[model samples]
Target: MDLFDAINQRHSYRGPLLADPVPRTDLRRIIQAGLQAPSGRNAQTTEFIIIDDPVLLAKLQAMHPANQAMQQAPAMIACLIDRQPAAVYEGYNFQIEDCAAAVENMLLAITALGYASVWIDGWLRLEQRADRVAQLLMLPTDKKLQILLPIGRPAEHWPQKERKPFAQRAWFNCYGAEETPCQ
Candidate 1:
């Protein structure tokens, strides 16, 4: 598929995901796309924990309170970053931003490959929970969990969501200034 089609077709599939396993080659390609994302100061801190093992997936599902759909996913990706490199930031760490960009790229690539995916954000901010997940994944001591993404083929229909007009959400040089209206 073309880039435009991928962007337009991408959506957070929340219903059910097919049980068919995602090929490791495809997963590697998706992760490679993520790695292509830009990094701050060339730190290249983004790390990916691609989990296709059913037992491990179940372990991660147990971490959630009531996310049954997680088990339906054939595979999931845990986006992470090594803080040792990110710590070089003077005040703020851009690891989260960098990893998030990588995740978005992966999501787009998943869509392009005729697959479905959803962003799992809350998993990264829970109290001591993310730390446990990191340990479970055997991540490096300096690595920190950022986000998770469950990917698979869609088992249910997912229609495109409505979006606001460009004029309302866009500005030329400042917020609240409608510089370019949708035509």
Candidate 2:
């Protein structure tokens, strides 16, 4: 798919996924897209762990008792950020921003590559799930699991959610002052 199409199609897929496994090669490509994302001060504080093992998948699945997508995804990517990231520029650690950029890139890549995934961050934040996942993956104390993406072929289809008009959300010269903004 082209870049625009990927951007348009990339949505949070919370539905069940097909049982077919996602190839390691594709997973690598997806993660590579994330790695290419621009980081604040080029700190590049985000790291990733790709998981495809059935045993481990089962363990992760158990964490999300209500999310079918989490249970059925054939693969997953864990975004890790430094727990105590050193300030790279302006005494600011951009791990969170870097991680978000990376996740968005990966989500687009996932759409472009004919796979689907959901950004599973909030759920991970609940119930100390991120900590558990970090422990499960044997991450170092410096690293914390910041995001999780469940990857697989979607079992069901859903319409892309509508987005608000550009005119309402954006403006040419100032904030929300466009009587008629050019597209």
Per-residue error for 7 in candidate 1, Å, reads 1.2
Clashing pairs in 2: none
Go through the candidates in order and give the clash count of each. 0, 0
User: Candidate 1 residues 22-139, lDDT tens each?
Assistant: 9999999999999998877767778888999999988887777455447578899988877665364675567877888898899899999988988888756877888888888998
Q: Rate the local accuracy (lDDT) of all candidates.
A: 0.83, 0.91
TM-score of each: 0.87, 0.96
The count of backbone overlaps in candidate 2 is 0
Per-residue alpha-carbon lDDT of model 2 for 1-183, expressed as tens digits?
Answer: 999999999898899899999999999999999999999988788999999999999999988978888989899999999998899887878889999999999999999998989989888888888999998999998899999999999989876899998977977766777676545
Tell me the lDDT of model 1 at 81. Answer: 74
